[model samples]
Target: MLSIDYQQLLAPIQQFLQCETPVTWLDVAQQPAQLPILLTDHLICELKAAQSAMYLIRRYAVDEQSGEALLQWLKPYEDFTYRQQGDWRALADIKLKKSMIPKADSGFGQELIDKMVLLIKEELHHFYQVLEVMQQYKVPYDKISSSRYAKGLLRHVSTFEPNALVDKLICGAYIEARSCERFAKLAPLLPADIGAFYLSLLRSEARHYQDYLQLAEQIAGDAISERVAFFGKVEAELINAADTDFKFHSGQPLAFSAAVGA
Candidate 1:
């Protein structure tokens, strides 16, 4: 029972950004044979996204309530990943975090923290959903190497205080935006259930990107246009470049037949 009216949510998000996701993302969705691998990568990426949010919460958001809420929100995924409790009966009552990060010390910290926590919750929920789907489809889980996408984007950080944080936030915006864009592009290609689930994510994912961009702007208190432009080029290159791994966030497909072929 997906609650999203995807077309309504995605139109504004795509319009707000200066970019559109590449079409190839949907192409992957159409190849159901590849879904197992794609979803495995997707599951890991979701947890990684959640971890990024948790790090921000721990580092900047000083509220104990927010921390507890985060822990509670992530309980299902954490239980499954660490404690191996992903049985069907164990996933019924998953709840999102209740606390919001405060905008006191630095709006940047609180704002990003709030958005990221929600994003993480959704991503992990999505992860759980994907795992369920995988189990139904008989896709076995395996630990795989990460793609160069995140690493490539992270390499551009300024190696200093606010600048580094700013850069990271900007990168986050691109990642979330790209994800939203990809969801929009791919949802229709999937089967009814999975398609509905992906479409359901559009609203939150779009808002998450906007939240990241807004935080980047507020954190700088000045024109981040240049920084955005700088990262735009970098992100575009990473998206367009050649890559061997097939990850949720991997670069342009390498045309190599094998899923993990390096």
Candidate 2:
């Protein structure tokens, strides 16, 4: 029932990313038996996305008090996800108020807080939504190993200050863009409800990537095309290379069929 211009939404994402999600990955992802692993990994990815945004805000924008508050806001999700000690139903009521985050004095601090706050909210909510979907489908969560996709990109980050932050942001952009692109391409091949849910994420995922790029450029005070392109190649290599771990952000599957629904 969702209606939007798919072509227009995905055009920039397609352009930003150097390569598409492999047919082999999509083929494995859409298999009916892979639901548990897909949903579980997706749940973790959402929490991880929120955590990344929180890290950025705490590191670059917010005061210590604000950072701790942000952690408290996300603690329930972490407990449920990692510690396995919470009622998922209660998550719906756990919310972060705008007033809770006290701004600090930093270059582009307000902007970073604003955009990352938005991204954190959405990612957390999407985490809840994924849990809801899993509950409906009776998919149990699982603790799985991390994939090399993110580490591959992070390995090349500069050791310097501004460059380190900028590199991370560019990597963030590539990650978000790739996620959006994959969601779009995989939606139609899945069940209707799941497909719609995946498609629904297109707008925010697209915006998150753009916001990362904008913030990176603002912090860099110069064009980041060269660095962005470098991360683009790195991200593409991770996406295209053979990967053994099958997680939400995993690369091409090597022997992941038996590991499905982890």
Q: Which candidate leads the pack in lDDT?
A: 2
66-136: candidate 2 lDDT, tens digit per residue? 88889899999999888898899899998885454546458788888899999999998999999889988
Each prediction's total of clashing residue pairs, residues at least 3 apart in sequence or on different chains, is: 0, 0
**On a 0 to 1 TM-score scale, where does candidate 1 land against the true structure?**
0.79
Per-model TM-score versus the true fold: 0.79, 0.94
Q: Model 1 segments beyond 4 Å from truth? A: 1-8, 11-29, 63-79, 82-110, 257-262
Highest TM-score scorer: 2
The superposed Cα distance between candidate 2 and the true structure at residue 185, in angstroms, equals 1.2
Model 1 agreement with the true structure over 112-215: per-residue lDDT tens digits = 66677677767777777877877877887766677787788889988887777778888888877778877666677777777777777777778877777787
Instruction: Identify the runs in model 2 with alpha carbons over 4 angstroms from their true place.
Output: 1-4, 97-104, 256-262
Over the full model, what C-alpha lDDT does candidate 2 score relative to the true structure? 0.86
Return the TM-score for candidate 2, rounded to 2 decimals. 0.94
